[model samples]
Target: MKELAYLNKFFFKYKWQLLPGVLFVIISNFFAVLPAQIIRIAFDLVNENIALYRLFNGFDKQSLILDIFGSSLLLFGGLVIVIALIRGLFLFFMRQTIILTSRHIEFDLKNEIYNQYQKLSLAFYRRNNTGDLMNRVTEDVSRVRMYVGPAIMYTINTSVLFVLIIIAMLSVNVKLALYCLAPLPLLAITIYYVNSIINHKSEKIQRRLSTLSSFVQETFSGIRVVKSYVRENNIRDGFAKESEAYKSESLDLVKVQAFFFPTMLLMVGLSTIITIYIGGLQVMNGKISSGNIAEFIVYVNQLTFPVTSLGWVTSLVQRAAASQKRINQFLKTKPEIINPNPNPLKVNGAISFQNVSFTYPDTGIKALKNVSFEIKEGELLAIIGRTGSGKSTIANLVMRMYDVDEGEIKIDHTNIKYLNLEDYRSQTGFVPQEVFLFSDTIARNIAFGQDQLDMQKVEKAAKDAAVYKNIIAFDKKFETFIGERGITLSGGQKQRVSIARAIIKSPQILIFDDCLSAVDTKTEEEILNSLGNVMKGKTSILIAHRVSTIKNADKIIVLDNGEIVEHGTHHLLMNKKGVYFELYEKQLLEEQQELS
Candidate 1:
């Protein structure tokens, strides 16, 4: 019961559909029991009339006998048909309302999980794998629906039939009814033990399945790397290992069911044997009529089905419980990054970091320490750093991907924590170092952030990003479909497309985190030249490894060991002959070697 408490919200939400469905189930079960009663009455009528005919032999009793049997048979046949028709009608409506409602709830739960995924911080995504999350949204949600649908339906059906049949059986003979139900307590004990094992096994099986799914997802996502390294056999072996583990856990669950079903059937079979032997003896001793004995046999047989169905329903309940627990835990996780203020001040692109210190989660070392900087509106600032100098960390902090451990980051003279995260982010456009594009057309990808595509704006942005000529060279122009992650396009084209996407947003501040690393110097210069007009009167931050990419910026900052070691123009940094100058000389020597 505690395991199922998570479903209370869904049950309440769909109560309108579920309440009527439950009523129909009750009505259907009631009609279902009427046939057994009809049979009993018909048998009794035949027995009594036969005795009367035997007593009144050779008289005008032939007509009476014919009338009695004829009326009894007609009433029994008509009632059977009517009851069957009513039961079938109600069963249809019950399934339509309850089972279909579960499906609707399943749909809603999937969307809700996806919505939660969107709201969660980047750290949450880092902690979980894609395939495990996919399994939770798909397989786990499906198991929950089984509980809401067939499990609930059969439980209700079994309860109603059990009560009505027990009452009818008692009315015939209390002693026989007691005897018929003697094995039920044993059956309940068996189910209790079996259910616990099943629940434990089910949890293990679901976890193994998620592991298998994650392995498959990762293998496919990095297939190119695997193939380039000629590790197909290794990957195949890894997959086989995961698949075997999954298979082993599944077989354990199957073993539990194998033990459970036969035990339940044995109990039901024993009860049926007891009822027949005892009721037959009563018939011979004249304690009960033959008709009563026959009806008792029918009632016991009817009870057998629901009792046997209990084993299956219990398994479904256990599986659903295990799945719901996983989903509940995921939903309980709150995002670490959230807007503190409902109404926040507008951003004007003026940014400042005051003695900020930060460390990554699950790591002892600080990524940035006591970093302080300010960029006035409409100024272009360039950040140059060696690998692991915390350049990307700075970009992440500016995007509010993680909060600072000390001091404050301010935008428009207000702490970023007090700003509406969405509104503040909307005012800035970011092109990450590794760009990702959807499997969509050029125009659609360019206008991805907009509610609707404006072709004019899209073309202008593409031209500004210097990718419009390459796009028009294609036969379909903007309508050309790029493959997954823009696989159909070159690296430079993908980078330009990403820039076009950001440009169309018309953000007040633009941040490029080594977005042009893939392109040649000539192409890089072309893009930068095209962006000159766009960057006018807008705050811009360019983070790059190449000095050529940021040499002409208003001011350049060089980072070493997570601290700014040089702050000046490119010419001034070169004259200082420090870390920045060393990096510039190294790059120049590499280019000269390539030409040679």
Candidate 2:
């Protein structure tokens, strides 16, 4: 019930449909109760010996023939017609209401989740699996839709039918009504207990279902890897375990439901027997009329349906409650990064770090320790380091992927954190080590976000990256669709395309994190030479492992153990005989040995 409260506004928004639907249900129940009355009336007429004779009275031979055909049994025939019409109308309205409400609610929920996904930070995705998030968006949301549709309306109808039946029963014979309702208090208590058990188990059941959904999604997405590695048997065994667990959990919930529903029916059966036995005695003793006993029995059966229906409705509500909790948890998670009074900064490409330090949230280990550097506009700065020397961390910080624990990063003398994230990020072009390309046309991928891209500019960038010839050789040229993750292209081609994408963006600052590592040295030099003219007056941070890659930079900063150890030009650093010089000499010797 608490979970459902969140949707009160949507319910109110569609209450017009609900109101008519409820009215139709009540009208249908009214007609349904008529059969009981017609039965009582016919029984009384028979007991008085007036049924057949009176129906045929006041008719001559000719009129008698007409009356026999036209004077049909009025009470029973009228009830049949009434019930059919009412049921038709009710079914029509209920179907329409359920369809409209479910679609509207589902649309609203998906939209809200999408909005929340946009607001969340990259850190959230780092810890969460894509398949798990997809499950919540699709499966869990469908469960909530079911609750809002048929479940809510049916519950209301059950409650109304119960009250109507009770009133009709007590009117004819209060004693029999009280006696038949004797087990109701106990039935309510039993339902409460069953509901509590079902709710607890339902939580586990939904969680297991989510896990099963995630397993299927993850396995399918990585099916190629599984096939390549010949791990089908291992994957099958793992999936079987998850599937079996989900099956067991689902069966357990079904077992509880199976047990509780029949027990409720048993209670209904017991009450029916009591109504027949106790009411029959009263009739035989001449304390009550036979027609009244018949009516009382009819109402007793009517009462049973609502009570039994209550159990199933309770189960659905419990399942919905569990789903709502999971969804709410996701909705409540505030993004790790947020702007506190943002001011958009227009960068002139001068970037500086003043005593910046950062630690990961989960590990609490410093990724960067008091790291500081400055690069003026148009400078080609190279960041060189061994793995885990904080080279990548510096790029991440510059992009504000993670906030600094202590100190400030400024662009054009303004703190980067204070700038609007979107604005700041737009001015920086980032190409990571693992180039990710969408499964789209090469032209679309290169001109990613810009609405109207200049194809000439795109061609120039591609030519500069040394990948234009490759693209032109393809069947559709720039229009060729790259298969998933650019699986259709070679590693070097993919890297060059990524470089082309960054170059087309024309950002004030470009950060290339080992983007050219996949290409050969000759191709790399060609691309670098082409970039030299375009990179004029633009700040560029090049992260690379090979000494030859960064040797041409205006300044090289060599890092070791998360701290800067050396900073100078290629010749100056070589003369210093430090870590950079040793690595450069070793790389040069390897090249010489290969040539020999």
Candidate 3:
């Protein structure tokens, strides 16, 4: 499979472990074939065969009995005992290596997927669900490990076992060996049909499983909204429907497995019967001795187990194939932004968009069309717009989140595409609209963006964001661990912490994507004031929905339908009798009326 080829390097990495595992299997099979020949020799010796009696004289009946019932059997049983012990020992190590190999692959796959996620543009997340992506990272990767590890081992072992049995059987009686193998072709055909059904059903099961995982994640995340809106029953019913689909699909896979294994056993039984009947006739007709017929029967069953193992191995393969397709898709995704020329741009807080046009990847419609803006050093510009008017797109472009389809964007007069993405991003700080905090101490979260520690700077940033008092109120102070998604804090508190994170970066340019939306207007004003002093001599882009928030900007740009409709100083825009004036007037009236 083209998709499976991606795992070639990983398989080669652990060949040391696999090599010993292969050797142990060979050794086990070698001893396994010896016993059948030994039994034939014993049969010959009992019938007054002088050669076998002379050959086995040292370990006679007394010695064999003592070895079995006393101590002499140990020598006679040496091959069997050593084979079992070596097989068991190697099996234990093999299991350990398998687990380690699976975990190692899992770790690499997760890291690769995560790093790709980081490199991808924001449009990628816009097109994919948060929950669905989580499923790919966790559930899909585990499935690949299961397939590559145990399934691979069993497939190899089974093939080897079958080959060794056939060789042993032919050495005793070629005609009977051929008869024993007659049922195998038919069995192969049946397994082919059964595996096809399993493959089809397994893909369906995996799809339903992803949907089920997504539904549970989405419902739990929105549990508050569901409860407040009295939609618990609706969500519960939806989850139940998804869960039932997953159950039904998994049952379909099991249905194929249920039939496949039993059919395999039936085929094995038929082969054994054929070998015994045909070999029985040869012995009676004096074509072969009874001892040879007995040896043939034992080898026939040895061959049967590998055949049965095919069914189990097939099931694991199908599950893996489905998972591999998803991972391959992730690996093949192309980032929206790439370095056509790898050069580092030295940033000085000035940015320009020259007749830029951009569109979201999954949608044909433009999010920012014919947009041009210039931000000079030490200037604060506010962006105000209605809900879908490309306010966030402008901020994304400044950070090179998505490259413009037409025209160019530059930082400090250098084209952003030529710059190394890591170096370019290092010069900028963006505080997103939705605040996301990790489950760590406040101090650590604030300093998360930087590589080195600076506790004093972190304390100063927290104070500047106006959350120092709140942090100190906790008994643990800056060391307090916020629970998942900052569940321990209020909405406004989370926003402040995120602002503190941006402040700690002290980047050349800062873009706050409506980061002040949650706090009260008074707190908003205080934080903005603090930002102005801290961000002096640096470029800042403030995005907000409130008129009071951006009235003091050196310039304010009004956006509508992915186009810039107005641009001027706040006061100048208010006197233009355009869209900006209407918004300001409407907001003023609403505020004045609220006072009444």
Tell me, by lDDT, which candidate is best. Answer: 1
Per-residue CA lDDT of candidate 3, range 484-572, in tens?
Answer: 78878899989999989987977888898998888987899889888888889889999998879999999899999999999999889
Candidate 1 residue spans exceeding 4 A from truth:
53-67, 362-365
Candidate 2, after superposition: displacement of residue 494 in Å? 2.3
Q: In candidate 2, what are the lDDT values of residues 1-596, reduced to their tens digit?
A: 78767777878888887788778778767766777777777666556545445565775554664455344457566776777787778767776876577779888987888788877876787777777688778877887887888678778778777877888888878888888888888888899889989999989988888788878888887787999999999999989999999899989989999988888888888888888888898889887778877887787787777777788788888888888778887888997777764665677899999998888776667888888889999899999988888888898888888888999999889888677788778878888788899999998888884667779988998998899999999999999999888888999999989988888878889999988889889998998998887788899999998898889999899998888889999999999999999988888899899999
Give TM per candidate. 0.96, 0.91, 0.92
User: CA RMSD for every model?
Assistant: 1.7, 3.1, 3.7
Give the total clashing residue pairs for model 2. Answer: 0
**Count of clashes in candidate 1:** 0
| Runs in model 3 lying further than 4 Å from the true structure | 43-79, 93-102, 340-344
In model 1, what is the error at residue 133, expressed in angstroms?
1.0
Number of clashing pairs per prediction, in order = 0, 0, 3
For model 3, which pairs clash? 66-72, 67-72, 67-73
